[model samples]
Target: MTTRAAGVATPRRAWLGLAVLILPVLLVSMDMSVLYLAMPTITDRLDPSGTQQLWILDIYGFLLAGLLVPMGNLGDRIGRRRIMLAGATVFGLASVLAAFAPNAGVLIAARALMGLGGATLLPSSLALISTLFPNPRARATAIGLWTAFFAGGTALGPIIGGTLLHSFWWGAVFLINIPVLLILLLAGPFVLPEHRESGRGPMDLPSVLMSIGGMLPLVYAIKEIAAHGPAPIPAVAGLAGLGVLVAFVRRQRTLAEPLLDLDLFRRPMFRLAIVSSTVGMMSLAAMSYLVGIWLQSVRGHDALSAALLGLPGAIAVFAVSMIGSRVGRRLGTGRAFVVALTVAAVGNLLLLGVGVDGGVGFYIAASILIGIGDGLAFPLVSELAVASVPPERAGSAVGISETSFELGNGLGLALLGSLAALVFRSGGDFAPTLGETLDDAGSDTGLARAASEAFVSGMHVATIAAAVLLAATAIVAWRTARTQPAAAVGVSAEPVGARH
Candidate 1:
């Protein structure tokens, strides 16, 4: 086995291993959105209640977010490859179960199992990259590819789902994972190297429980509030989650082998990177959700057509992600982030001009701009987070980085989505969402027009809110990057591809 040393170049085997690792990364991200087009079909067949349908859609993400930290730490203690392979096996089996599930409850259970597996896949796969590419510049390039694939997977989910549902059943989406995962399982042992920290003690069960208890309730509360406004149950759950998380942090500080290392946050760059990532992802998720609704509800496009319309933006994201690190090298990481975020902010601002009647060209332009910005920012944030820590602690760092992303996605949907919903309700006696409003409006042309106008108003407000947030984040990133030198941030000062 070759040791990962600073001066060493990345081997051909490492590139081969990266190809192997990409399979699970792609699938894990795709699973997050693959159900969007299939949901109506699923609902019709399973006849689940409104709440049950929501659970079926949401449980996977909730469980995945809740378990990421614990699983990351677990991978550190055990072996990243081992955890990753086990996760793939479970994910594959769960996909089979979900594909064949006859009832809503069974499907929900299977999705939850898939979440459990996904938690392992994301962090372990990212951390394993550190072992494969020890050179910081090469590592940055590899991480850029990783980020690209992940973004591509997420963007492709709807298109792929729409295509699958065109001829096949809703279950085909889940079944498609089987063959890809089978490849991962077959080639993983031969190509991927195992990595674990030496001399780590047993995991703290209480910490694991606390993290799960804290995250699940918090995430669920966020989703509930976004869906149905502030209720007593979600309010209490949110508060309780916060309390437990505070306790969890304290316990980590006191532990000999903490589940999460709090000291990592001591580095200002790491903290800033996390914040940037969170805000970037938040804007992306909120915009994606809003735009998807707008296309189907207002523009009256079918699922496949809407997805196709959005394809160029997705392609832009994929392309920018691949070159993000190279851009960072030219401009320097800090300035690069400023430029990227500012561009995204501009994109969000463009959405304010879109009207209920027509703005297809404007919307497409906005999406491509947003895609460029997010694509550039995401990879750098991941590279910075991983580079901020020692190799042995990479899994934990990746977990934290990824957790920020998950939380950001949830928060964007909750906060911005709720804002839009509130605006829609205030305009008239409209339903919480545009879809429901149109469904209720039916053949009443006046009501439909009114509802459409109100929904567009809500979208504008949400879009502006997203824009303001991005701009504010950009200013903060600029200031922070200036104050904190690259070396102090646990990153090398040399330009990308620089060698000793």
Candidate 2:
């Protein structure tokens, strides 16, 4: 173990290391974007059924989210850099496999493998920053950069994929990953220092299995319920998942060395931070999920144009996140979130005017506002989540935080997005999904126009629901901030191994 002055400024080497850490962030996000943009192409080539296509698209996120906590714990137990390097290796190989798969099943298998590799990369990269930047403020800034780059990769994914798909095959998008992974593999161990718990106990297999098992079914249940309305099996699966998670928690309470230190939630600050992050991310995901479809399916834009529209919002997130720490210092984390959420609420409200008519201006305005709000608030919550734990246990803590973000993506799509679908179909007969609804309206100009109008109606409902959620979150944050204890320590100078 090593120690440093509590207030020591981050060194140049750590900045360099931060650059290396952003690779996985970009890789995972870019991969998501490319997959999304390449879906039709994949379906065309693989000729998968609707269910198989859904699995192909979602399995990556599902497995990645499910394994995050365990993988984060694994990194803490073994070593951050080692897992990072290993994850990158696996991710690169999986990309190659996915690029040239013989069939849908093989591609699904390859995507699941990519999910494991993604799970390893995120928590390890985030936790490594704790070791690198001992100062709380510097760490927040670094996280801001990480968030910005993540937004950049996501925004670029579709753009890049569209370009590649135009000139080459869908595999070209996967090939783009090869160079990035090669660079990360070569630069990582040389630049990023290894960090892990010094006295980790025996590996806890039950908890590991429980965590993965608990998450997989729960997420699948949520997605299925959203996609197909309430059903007996998913509802039962959800309950069963709840039971497994309860058991997992019970075992953690009795274990000498818990896989995740459940005690961290004891702090009000940590708990509040997690909630804020989850809800904030939910808003972001719901926005992207809705607007992406709204643009293409409703507004009659190409995927490339829709991707272009998303770029401004992504840029706003990057700009605001980079400066978010300063905003937090001025307003306090709680107030910063409140303000950001209000902005987000307003952003959502602006989109209430988005319709089958000419309201692209309002949509674009809403995009910038939402981006600004997320930029302002996202770092504050994430920074607090990372700061709440000691660097030695950083992987697990950050894993929980990261998981909350993934949960937001899952739940936002399920809850708010589903509600919108329900509202749209309530008035008349409609297809199961927006894409399907529009696709079924093929060649009938009136039906296409009517479908767009109906989808916009749903979009309005979703955005309004989103706004209410953000407003409620802001109020809760206000109360929490008022009562938050000042002793909420983000980090300490205890002899954690110094990043060399």
Candidate 3:
């Protein structure tokens, strides 16, 4: 029989483990935003080419996507805590290296290392939560906390970065990870339980390689297309990547332990959730990145000012998301998803009115809408994704959903961000007075500011694209919601306990 604790004792270890699991999410989301602010600072110091700049930005997500499955599988085989701690350690070290790096190339390399570490961190942490919290109510509550961290991180990045920038430099943004990781390292071993995969199958090496080969090239090609329109290199790379992906799927069909279980998509709810999440990310992620640049570069808002504009969204997300699970239960999950998507599309359209001349109020209002939309949509989508699989395969399914999120965010920024850059460069639009003033600080600052206009324009392009994609997704999800059988899917109205 299981031992029972007396006198209202809660499991401190499990709660601490859950906190450790969220550390990576906090770091990754914060860093992603901080870099958008830091880009102007980085380019001023480093003088990287436009392409190199995109690489520095896109590589982090690309590498994260490329390695997530294999690393996630490895963690399952070895131990989730062991893998997560190892990842945290690597990430911390990479951050220190990035902070002190002298050249752009070194910094880019360090960021890539950080990405690999991040891939390990996300899947392992998610799987650990799944393993720790087996009860549905506990799992929902735990996942709710996890979702809260994501929103918090997204909102907090600029505040932290702005503070750091005032006292230090761009590198400080990276350095901040060290202290967080150090704390995790000390606490993790003592508090987090070790859990290992119970299944028996060889890790599929060939499938892993094909997945990496296919995804990275495709991501790279897409980034290139965004940067340079339909360039030959991107064209060839895109075609090659697609072909490799097709072959990878074919190989997965025969493999005993496939890196990604393709059959998961056969479930209508799972398929719809992934598709909707991708489109959501494609829209929201692009807008988030672009909005930062537009605020700082075009509207001349400081880091803190730009972050403040987003405050309404963050607050709305926190407040609205509290009601999301209930709403999902009330409306039916698919119907709830449709409603959320529609609201989000409207939010994106609202952002179209926010121009360089618009007052701060407009931007803030737009952010609130976007935040509410996302707040409503993301959790529902996550709920649908998690509920799609049997409890036994939950770990793997969570990894897939996380992978989609990371890839969607990366692709949104790369493709939409790049298109904005190209449009601005082609138009030759820069604020001469602002350019002169920035130059007065130094030549580095001048070049950086000059690049800022293109960046802002790029952001606009991304916002527009995001809006279009979200609108399309809303239509698709609404049409598709009719087919889902209510009996096959269960909605647990009761509160979930810790996904420890």
Candidate 4:
């Protein structure tokens, strides 16, 4: 029996709810990676500008990151379950629109709406786990499983999308979500419990607007700088975004009930966890693009073939997340994450050796290591990041971490993607752009070989940069573990009363 009275409810029914909660995350995570292989198809069909192409990839994350805080807090005050249901509806509707969108602008808008729906879904599911599990160790394990499904979705996206693309059209990926949404809609009310912060003040509408305004501009600046190099417009956008952020921070100080826990940063584990997860996620994001290019651009593989190449890495990631939980429990959670980061660094460094002829075998081997490292590290960091706050504020805590992930994905596309692009252009063996690089190489055996080799050379530099960043993140995590020393793993295991 799991009682609702608050002191660690041990309800058997919560496991069923957990299964239900995994649905939204599984769908959302799949959305992240599924579109990558489909991008080339979209480009051909939509005939978008370079900037528009980036927007189609980025807008979902941008809108989702910008709205997370407001949405998370809203869930806290009104109810997590209600917010989740509303988001599911939005996500389902957005998926249909995105599937049928005729132009770049409409597709971008649809993706942004999906992002909005994601903002509501991701945090609520994670937060609910905080209340459902009573024992610390069990909670940690549960968090690991949640991260596993999330990881699995990203891994499976390519194969699933690839298979669909092989047989059908690009829109088939979006259409697959319809049936999943129906299940969530019907089962959610029966198993998912509702939680709300009763004493919390009304939602801050102005703050919500400010967050979106500030983030949209900042991300625009970053993306433009990547595509066209620095210019006056991007510079102005950057400053304006910074100013808005400052104003938002000040506004939080004045509000009787702030939207976020401004003081959450005071905890060392909390701060480091965000930094660690964001950096790790950034590497993964960069790889997402590079892998697609490697398959389609360099190897001349179709979309399904490209997506299939990622299957091994995806399996490694899902396996690590599922099986590493016990190992993480045995080791201090902080130390486990640090070890995983070190492993990931080693994996990134291996890319330095890849050449034009670097066989699929080489790529697969490197990807497996990278996948295992990320799979092990990400979940531990996420669990720590959210668990640092009080149970009641779980939504806000998850919102902050999830925001970092969204921002990292965007930044990865801009920064690392730009670095690789720059290196590719400077080779002077081919034209400055990928389109011309391929066109100029067409029908000429020597030029095509040179172009392929040049692209790999660019990848070498990007890999070095990624390795250095991962090492730095690992060092930061290591030092924090040395000093802070985790308080306790599992305090007590108490069962609660509830109905099945």
Tens digits of per-residue lDDT for model 1, 16-126:
899988889899878877776566567669877655665776677678777888899899889999999999999999999999999999999999999999999999999
Sorted by TM-score, highest first, which candidate order results?
4, 1, 2, 3
The model with the greatest lDDT is 1
The sequence of per-residue lDDT tens digits that candidate 2 reaches over residues 81-176 is 999899999999999999999899999899899988988998999889888887766777788888777655655676677667767888888888
Report the error of model 2 at residue 121, Å.
Answer: 0.7
- Per-residue lDDT of model 4, residues 1-500, tens digit only: 44433456567787788888999998988887778778777877886766777788788877878987888888888899999999999999999999999999999899989999989998999888887776665677678888888877877777788779889988888989989988989999999999887876788888899988988888788777766689999989988998898899899878866665566666666666677677877787777777677778777788888778889989998889875666656666567768888888888777666566656776778788988998987686667655666677778778888787777777776677767877876776566545456766669878777777777877777777888898998888788778745522221111110000
What TM-score does model 1 achieve against the real structure? 0.91
The 0-to-1 C-alpha lDDT of every candidate, in the order given, reads 0.81, 0.76, 0.70, 0.78
Per residue, candidate 3 scores C-alpha lDDT tens digits across 44-85 of 788676677767777787787778778877777777788888
* Cα lDDT for residue 288, candidate 4: 73
Off by over 4 Å in 1: 1-7, 39-54, 100-106, 226-229, 431-433, 485-500
Model 2: CA > 4 A from native: 1-10, 33-54, 101-106, 135-137, 162-166, 424-431, 485-500
Error of 2 at 102 (Å): 5.3
Better structure of 1 and 2 per lDDT: 1
